[model samples]
Structures are given as structure tokens and as C-alpha cells.
Target: MPDDDATPRAPRPALADAVHEIERHVAGGGWDGPVRVFALVRTAAALDADPGLADRLPAEAVAAARADAAHLTSVEQEGLPQASSLEDLLARLSWPQTVDGVALVVERVVLPSAAEAAMPADPEEALAYLMAHPDRQDVRIAVGVLRDGGSWCAVRARANDDDAAVAGGADLVPGLVAALATTLE
Candidate 1:
């Protein structure tokens, strides 16, 4: 006997898959340097692909995705920001809900002695020098975030022993994380 009154089930939320990908990425010390990662998703596509998410998603967000399909991009193909530029990069980006989530794997810059010597005392000049000398840097802290407002961070300091400290070290980039979170909002 067929159950005509029953509604069909929605697909799994696409966010689950994306979060899983993040988990896998960080599982094996894979993240080594500063990288700004974003998951630019089309709300329509996400819903079509994972209808289960509709129950939790707001109408406005879905509308925004439909309206801005042109701006949507796949993270798989586009890849993360591959440089160590720690400038106010987030200031330049303000994505709508249709754009999905963004994650950042950032590292505190440690300059080589020679490069540090060459850098000017002026902050502006130092920024310019660092921008031109990407080769002379090493990154240590890595943070990841999801559109649903979940966040994670990892650290690889020169001599880190306390797990609590490493976990708590996420506080080091609250401003950046806050900025990235707005993209999902």
C-alpha cells in the first residue's frame, strides 16, 4: 500500500558536507600558512542540492542567493587566498547571506632577521615591505568557520605544549573572525 499523505524527505544540509571537508583538512596538520578560505555558495543551488536546509534557512537569505547567483562561486575551483597578506583584507569583503560562509587560516607573521632589519620603523612602510616580501614569512595560527556560525582554530607555535593555550589562542584573531562571520550574516 502506498502512503500518499507522506511528504518526501529533503536532502542532507550542504553545510554538513562543507564542515566535514574542513574537519578533514585540519585533521592531519594540513594547514601550514596564512590562507583566507571562503565557501561562496548559491542559496538556490544549496537548497536544490540539500533541500533539508530549507527548514532552518530564512526566506530572505534564499531570496538573496537567487538574486545574486552571478556572484556565487565554488570553493573547490576558486581555492583559498593563498598569500600571507595580513592587511585589512576582510574590510574589503561584505558578502550577503546568499554568498554562504567564509573561513580564514591565518598565521602571525614571523619575519626573517634580515628582512626585519630592512623593514622601516613606520607601520605603513613596514606593511609595504611585508607585502613585497611574502617569501620571508611563516604563519602559525589557523582558524576555520562555517556559515551556521560555528568556528574552530588551531595553533602551531614554536614550542607549544599546553592544549588549553593552543585552543584558547583563537582569541588572538577575534577581530578577523568577527569580520569573517559577517559575510555569512
Candidate 2:
């Protein structure tokens, strides 16, 4: 796989253009379906990639992004690949740069947060995805009320069981619990 950083990230779009696109998407908001989160965030990231586009996004986009994460997941699974290169798509959505840490956080943390309205689901498998991936982050901050003693957790390589990555649980489950509490609270 190519280095995400080295990849020509979708042409460093001009800021004004980025903002305009974001605003445009915001105006057409209320796309409340699976993958909505991804769409909503894409707007901001596009702007981040080009700050000039900030004025483009409407206020409603934030609300949509906050409320509809399941849709974001769907969008990532179904839409991103069709639109651009995975790196470009990921950049467009402001996905965490570290694939491994990102995978783990999304699976172990973000997924559970999304399910807050319904049954509490387990994100262990999701974490496993990150653990299995090669490009994992060495340290991740788990802040707020859920933080493990109000601290960040370091996810380093432990020489044991390279294959079995804290299955059914987070590598730093204790910190995860703390982080979740903060996020939920």
C-alpha cells in the first residue's frame, strides 16, 4: 500500500473552493440516512484541506454530522471508493491519518458511541481491525470523563500474540471505558 501522507491528496484544493463546496452540501442537508456522518464530515474536511471553503458550509451541516453517524459508516463503506482513491477519500473526510489507530478507534470507540440510542454494542472486532492493520498509532488520547484516570493510552507493540489483538476488547480497555464515559456524559 502507498503511504497516505505521500499520496497526492486530491490536489490541495483552494480554500475558497473548499468552503463553497461545504456550504453547498450544507444547504442540501437533511440527508438522514446511513453514511450521513461521512458526508457531513467530508464537507468540513474539504474545507480543512482548503480553508477558503469554510464560508460555504451552512450551520445545519454540523447538526447532521452530530446526529447521523450510522449513515457515515454506510457512506464510507459504499461511497468513498466510488468517488476517489482511498487516500483521497479518507483525506476528504478527515479520517484519522493512522490507519491502525483509526481502525481501532472507529471500531472500539466511535461505533459504540453511535449505538448510544439503542443497545450497547461491542466494538472489539472493530479494534481488531486496527490492531491487524500495519499502520497503527503508537499513542491515542482518551480524554474527558471516560479517560482512564483522565489520561491518554499508548498502544505499542507487545511481542506476544501478534495475531490475537485484544479480541472482544480494547488493547486499553480500561482507558476506553473512561473515554467512553467522558464522551457519553
Candidate 3:
């Protein structure tokens, strides 16, 4: 029912609901949701590192988690984020950090109530939004994480941007994690 090109999206605020739903899906226990959840939590951490990101949204960790769900969609398993706009965040990210401003973006939104919430609203628009964020030097942290995770499209966008600052900065970040992505992903 989902597609690879489908944009990654933001998650919502249904922690309890999500937990319950996941519990049912894997009533037997020892499910592998952590890998996906950790990835998003990391993304939120990165957003919190940015100074300007917080004023735009609070509770970034939640947002980051949802973004993670959207991204996990690529795997084509059960449960993910529902929002479409969040793809902008997902299509562009790789990690979230607990240090610095990354927390702001991480904690902004709420998660979904069930596995169905993973459904996206508008994949194309979300993808474009994610692509657009790294167009400048200001979103370096965001770009860095996304590029590191496996989002080559974000890396290419930054590498090819008109702004030398963004292009140059993006160039350096990916290499830092180049070796890591291969073994990590």
C-alpha cells in the first residue's frame, strides 16, 4: 500500500495509543520497533540543537519520532506516521541529537493513535519540503543528519545548491559520516 518515493513525514502525539497499538501488533513481545524509534529520537535531538528551530515548534522529540515513522515507511512494514507535511522533515533528515538546539525540533508535535496513523497525507509535497530545507547554510544540522542516515537526495541537493555556503558545508558533513552510514544502515 506504500511506496519508496513516498515522502517521509512527521509523527503525532499519541504515545499511549501508539504503544497500545504496537503492543497488539507484536503481542508476543520483542518487536523491532526500537531501530525506527531511535532513528527519529536522534533526528529530534539534531533539531533541538538549532537555535531558531524551537520558536517554530515545541516538543521536538515527538515531532522527530513522527518523522521517524514517516521514514520507516520505506521499509513497508506495519505502523508509521500519518501526516504528509512531515515528509519535508523526513526526506531531509538522518539523525536527532540530545545536545544543543536539536531538542526543539524533536519535541514539537504529537504522534499517532494506531498503525494506520502511519499513512501519509501528501507524499510529493512533503518530499519537496524536505528537499527545500537544506537549500541554505542555516539548516546544516538538519542536512547533516539526513545525509548521514541514507538520504542521498538531501545530500545531492545541498551539494548542488546555488549558495556556496550550503553546498560547501553539505559536502563536508556527509564525508564525516560516509563510513558510518555503510555499516550503520
Kindly state the number of residue pairs that clash in model 3: 44
Name the candidate that leads on TM-score: 1
* Highest lDDT against the true fold, candidate: 1
TM-score of 3: 0.19
Candidate 3, 1-185: lDDT as tens digits: 11144342222222222322222333223222221221222334444456464455446534644466422111112243443443333443333232111110111112234522443569786444444543322222212123223222111122333322322222233433343232223
How far does residue 94 in candidate 3 sit from its true spot (Å)? 17
TM-score per prediction, in order, is: 0.41, 0.18, 0.19
What lDDT tens digits, residue by residue, belong to model 2 across residues 50-94? 665445545554444344421111122234344343233334433
**What's the CA RMSD for each of the models?**
14.0, 18.0, 20.6
lDDT of 1 by residue, 1-185 (tens): 11133222221244333433443454345444335465647567777888886676767666655666422323532433443345456555555655555555555656778778888999999988887886554445554444545444455543443333343232345566556665555
lDDT of each: 0.51, 0.29, 0.29
- For model 3, state the Cα shift of residue 174 in Å: 5.3
The lowest-lDDT stretch of 10 consecutive residues in candidate 1 is 2-11
Off by over 4 Å in 3: 1-58, 67-174, 182-185
Tell me how far the alpha carbon of residue 105 in candidate 3 is from the true structure, in angstroms, after superposition: 18
Off by over 4 Å in 1: 1-34, 40-85, 96-100, 110-121, 124-139, 146-150, 158-172
